[model samples]
Target: MTYDIAIVGAGIAGASLAAAIGARARVLLIEGEDAPGYHATGRSAAFWSETYGGPDIQPLTTASRAALQAGGFLQPLGSLHIGRPRDAAAIDAFLAEFADTPVRLERVDPAAIVPGLRPEWTLGVSEPSCAYIDVATLHAAHLATARRAGAVLATRAPFHAATRAADRWTIETGAGIFQARVLVDAGGAWGDVVARAAGVDPIGIRAYRRTVVQLRTDPPAPAGLPHVAHIAGRFYFKPEPGGRLWLSPHDEAPTDPCDAAPEEIDVATAIDRFEHVVDWRAAAVERRWAGLRSFAPDRRPVYGFDARVPGFFWCAGQGGFGIQTAPAAASLAASLLLGEDVAVPVDPARYAPGRFGR
Candidate 1:
């Protein structure tokens, strides 16, 4: 059956976009794996911070807050950007960077916010609006919403090739062949691959591996502990129930798109960095995983139609801010996809795929 639009990935990007446009068009949510969100969406560390992904991305994150809160997907969990005396300039730059924005940031004592913070790590910036996102629930809700809106979901459908003829696309995938008037490349790390196979010029979307590890610390993590991150982008950690801690080195190692695995070095680096921040010791690593974060050359998400390919849309290059910004990003993409008025506050031109030349 021919669909009005066929989204090539059923992760958050595709699922959310499908939900946004499904009511207005015939939509198909294609998943490469047996289950949707088997990649980055499933491995997200699940936090929404307005300052994440830099100022260029803050607009989308801020715009999405209301929706996320209304859907009950957000729970109060503030964040603390901590730093050492030597990082004063970085701290000031961080503050100065978002000074013009509506995000609330205030100076605080690092030790007061994060218990056991080392004496050398003295400065802190508190972001009260930061919160934990119920990622699983959010993803499921989008999929359910799409289904209710008459969107079809095809699992195990890894897109292979596509050919455009008479302004329609014939798409080849693992599951089968399908036809759509518009084909969307929301394949996350494989977004460029999808574009290439669809006979469109790739937009230099590169994937990087990020690692996270759960640790049982020597001292049980405090329930009230805020999400702690280094100003220098060295590490970040947040408390989990049962006295566990979720930590990452903030490493963004460039790698090819694949099933990402936590490297031993990265896991070790996370623990090593954690020790310097606080007095607590890592008793054992309970779990470890990694996921890919794809980014355009400019590190901003790419949306809208491809400049060189008619009826081809891009909904990729979201990096780590995809989940937090999903609501606005999806709305913007939907508006572009359906020829509707843009509802999101952010300017769509900033994320337009045409920003990259063919």
Candidate 2:
């Protein structure tokens, strides 16, 4: 059967987009893995921080907050952007950057909130709007919503090739061949690859590996410990329910698309960085994993059709902010795809695929 739109990737980007499109169009959600979200979406250390993807991404994140909260996917956890004494300039810059934005930012004593904080790490910027996202639930809900709206999900359907003829696209995948009026490259890390296979120009989407380690600390992390991140982007850590701590070195090493794994050096670096921030001792390394975060050349999400490729849409390059901004991003992409009015207040032209030029 010919679908109105075929989305190549059943991760957050594809699933959320499909959910947003709803019954407005006949949709096909394609997944290369045996199940959807087996890649980046599944591996994300999910958190909703308005300042995560920088100022450009904040609008989408802010716009998505209501929808996410309404769906009961957000749990208030707050966030603290901590800095060392020498990072006073960075602290000031952070505040000045978001002064005009709705995101509430305030200065605070790091040690007061984050116990055992090193003396030198005196500066702190509190973002009270930060929260933990129920990623698995959110992803599952999107897929369910889309399915309920009559979208078909084809698992293990690795897109191999596609040829545009007339007004339809003949898409070949591992599952089988299908036809769709519009083909969306929501393949996450493999987005560019899908675009290339479809004879469309790639948007230079590059994937980077981010490492996270779950550690059992000597003093048992406090449940109230907010998500703590270094101003220098050296590391970030937050408390887990069982007195464990989730930490990341904030490393963005460029790597080819694949099942990413944490490097020993990266793990060690995270522990070393964590130690420097607080007096807490990491007693055991419980777990370590890595995920790929793809980004466009300008580090902004691409959410519109390719200007040069007919019936081809670009819905990738969301980086690490995809989960937090999914609702708004999906709304924007759906508007563009279905020729509807922009659902969110953010300017669609900013994230348009045309920004990269033909």
Candidate 3:
């Protein structure tokens, strides 16, 4: 049978897109893993902050607010950035860069911050617009919605090859073959690989490894503790459930696309940075894992129809903002494929794939 759209990689990007398109098109969602969201989507820190990405990405973040709230995917958890005296210039630059964004951020005195902090942190900037996202629930909700809307979702169906036939493309996978008028590539770190396999020119998407560690705290879970990050963002710590804390050194080393693993050095660096910032001792590491955040050369998402390949579309390179911006991004992708009006508030120029060719 033939489908209107065939989406590769059932991560947050693909699943969300599938859900957004709904019954407007016959959509086929394929994933190589035993289940959906088994890669970077499943390993995300899952925070929704309007101040996170670049200026161009602000519209997407703002546009996603309503969907996320209506879906009950967000919780009230504010975020704060702490910096030392020597880092004043960097913090000032950050505040100035994001001043026009919707995030409610304000700088506070270092002495005022030291009282609430663990005594090690000094200067601080707080944003009330930040919140925690229930990532698993969000992913599951989208998948369920897509299925209910008559979308075909196939797990463990790895795409092996693709060939254009007339106006449609035949895609062969381990499970079966399917034909579609349009193809969406949301393969995360392996996005370029899938594009090349389908005879599409790669847009130079690079995957960078990011390592994170979960540690068991000594006493309270720090549930209400503000998500903390230094001025340079070399490390960050946030409260987790069950008396645990998620820590990361903000490591971004270049890596090949695969199941990423944490390096010992990265873990050690995170621990050292944590020690310097807080008095808490990381007695034992409960768990450690790594995931790749794919980026375009310009460090923004790529979303548009392939200029050379008529029916091929690009929807990868979300970096770490995939979960937070999924709703708007998916809406944009669906609009582009269905030739419908852009529903979200974001401008097409910021995320268009053609920008890379210029």
Each model's lDDT comes to 0.94, 0.94, 0.86
Candidate 1 lDDT, tens digit per residue, 1-358?
Answer: 7899999999999999999886899998888899999999999999999999999999999999999999999999999999988999999999999999999999998787777878999899999999999999999999999999999999988889999999899999899999999999999999999999999999999999999999999888988998889999999998788989999999999999999999999999999999988899899999999999999999999999988889999999999999999999999999999998999888989999888776
Compared with the true structure, what per-residue lDDT tens digits does model 2 show for residues 10-35? Answer: 99999999999999999999999999
Candidate 1's C-alpha runs over 4 A off are none
lDDT of 3 by residue, 194-233 (tens): 9988999899999999989999856544556767777787
TM-score of 1: 0.99
Worst 10 residues of 3 by lDDT: 109-118
Name model 3 segments beyond 4 Å from true: 110-120, 219-223
lDDT of 1: 0.94
Q: Which consecutive 10 residues in model 2 have the weakest lDDT in total? A: 114-123
Cα error of candidate 2 at position 51, Å: 0.6
lDDT-superior candidate, 2 or 3 = 2
